[model samples]
Target: MLRTSECNSEQNVNADGYRLITNENKPPDIKYSKENSWVAGVQMFVSFLLAGFGMVAASLLLDLVQHWDVFKQVSEVYILVPALLGLKGNLEMTLASRLSTNAHLGHLETSLGTLIIGNLCLIQCQAILVGFLAAMAAVAMGWIPYGEFDIHHALLLCASSVLTASFASLVLGLIMIGVIVISRKLYINPDNIATPIAASLGDLTTLALLSWIASLLYSSIGTSVILPSIIIIVGASLVPVCGYIAWKNKFTKQALDEGWVPVVSAMVISSAGGLILDYTVSKYKGVAVFQLVINGIGGNMVAVHASRLSTSLHTGQKENSVLGKTTKLLLLMVIPGQLIFLYTIGYLRAGHTSLTPVFILVYMSAALLQVFLLLSISHYMVLWMWKLGMDPDNSAIPYLTALGDLLGTAFLGAAFIVLDVIGDKDSDLGD
Candidate 1:
């Protein structure tokens, strides 16, 4: 079910169904270089700042619109939010990670033209299919459990999810290319820089676009169904056209054939988080606001960890000596960085929580556990995938980021539940 083909490269799939690209990778593995701890600290901290702004912006936007009819009426928009955002991690960040690995391997110097075109085309094709599937998945997840299905609601969710995914992928894909290209020119590792920027903007762009598009389409509902229906049809139609272009390119056909287990499986995992969000949002007053920031921060930090491990593996450094230092640096930033965001949320105009001692303890506990586990997994995953003949660049990121979302969402939800329980017990004591 997995295959990767490159010129002069021998490829075979393992019994576990992962593809191994062998012996003849055209670019030589560069020896691992010592990264200055100071340079890495600054790079990741700056990236985290940008991500904080983005997460805050997304939180504000979601807060501003949660009472709006589009959210109230569709309900599945909550489902779409995480699913669509996860698509960015799955599709765009993966593209950035692959391109980063290629840049390190010197492919950009040797085969820039074909690699760029084929990669850009490949993601577009993926975005179309996965976007629509995410939409359908959102609709099904939102409705089937409750046995409540509305045609109009289904149509709106699909249209908005497609529009958000298509347009966001296009825009983010270009931005990621620019980020990676600039990183190469500056002699900065794209792994330390690109993925966090992608994650930051990914949440910001998808949330803004989804809200705007859903709002625009929602206004026409009951009055007219023309817009949503056309989007559903056109978005559905693009899958094949994009697929054909991607399939015809010798560079991309292998990935096209590789199909969607990683991305789709990631989507399904995020939907479980979405269901958690839906179930708890009303009961836990500010959980939705914290969800985007918690999930984005956890995912963003771990993505940096995963991308670094992938790059190190590609450079043929199997020892933890170098990687251990990198992990410590990344984790050091993660603890304090998340603390800033949590307090920043308290300062936000709406969806503000008291930031009580217990909540901080509980919330930080969850975030810490999520990142630690993900960081631990990243090193092993890249090594395991590489040994299995699978390209970790293409495979590891989506799963890591998606799992980050699930853990962030689940733990954040639990934090709020715990906070409420203690408050109730205190009320009884007061009486």
Candidate 2:
């Protein structure tokens, strides 16, 4: 077992008894050195810029939606979209955050042990479990009124979600770990660069994989049923086995114990967001493009905060306070992002909708509210997890971004109501 349960700031001494240490415990001096504020701001600016493009790239899902034949055939795919995206973002974001924290603690280099293997196993297991549940949800919900309760579709949804999630978890998870490790070696704050890159890349890769799998299923229903059946059996079988390993290991146990709250909550909330998108996506030409971007940017901003707060709590620098210098700087970073994306991308692509002040106000208000709520929740979640001897990095980003998806969707729907943006309820869902 790794000696990671130690919490005392004073006891963080080196092996030589000379107080020498690594970068994990010693965060960069940005919080203390006022001179570093400009550098911090510049780094965050670039990070969010990448995040904006990354999220916008994910809008290619809208392209899939435009294919009327495929879309009408696979209506449940709409429901699967947010859940799949949320699953990818949640799993990868958590991985990036945890790796950053581990790098900070110098425990990252100890890679050949049970903890590492357990984490990899846990990621795959959770992806499969969550994917299965999400597909079941889509099937169950579709049956209620839509009444498209074909077992074939359910199997496709289940198999596709599980396969995409597992594959992405393994591929993107390794890519992110490598990125975090390299960035840290180069003196870049993995906290700053890691989360956005992981999240954006996660969005891109997950959607691409999902599209491929769904297209394959559409190509041949027989092949789809056979392949997914095998995948579901294998994936379902491994869940318990992986759960047992995570339960036994010291490092992964804390994660396993606490992972469900964020994952389930995010899924439930993202379902709500999905419903809103389903209702309005047809009427609002560019809403599909902007929804993920807004949520992505909002989530990315919160991830940076969550990663920083985790480091502070672990290193005993900032306690649980959310209004520190770093928080303020991060909060400031969201303003221009909201304006730039909402005006340039969201507005322009919104089918020549007038850039009225009311539109801007409603959108900005919703985006900022989402950011603020995520930050507050992240701060408290980190504090609460820390109090219980758990690592917040394991769950914080996942929780925040999932909630961001929920709230961002809610806020957007509310804006639609206030401004009457969604026209003719029946027409909104036009075939």
Task: Specify the highest-lDDT model's number.
Answer: 1
lDDT of the candidates, in the order given: 0.77, 0.70
lDDT of 1 by residue, 1-431 (tens): 11334454455555644444443434443322567778888988898889777888888778777778998878788887787888767888888887887777666776677776777777877777777787788888877888988888888888888888889998998899889888887788788888889988988898999999999998887777788989878977877887787787666666666547788888888887888887877666577677888888878877887777776655545445434877788778767887888777667535746667777788888888888888888778777877766677777888888898888888888887787777721211101
Clashes of each: 2, 1
- State every prediction's TM-score relative to the real structure: 0.90, 0.84
- The whole-model C-alpha lDDT of candidate 2 against the native structure comes to 0.70
Look at candidate 1 and tell me the lDDT of residue 418: 80
For model 1, the stretches where C-alpha displacement exceeds 4 angstroms are 1-32, 321-323, 424-431
Give a tens-digit lDDT track for model 2, residues 238-273: 889888887777666777788887777777767767
Every candidate's CA RMSD: 4.3, 5.1
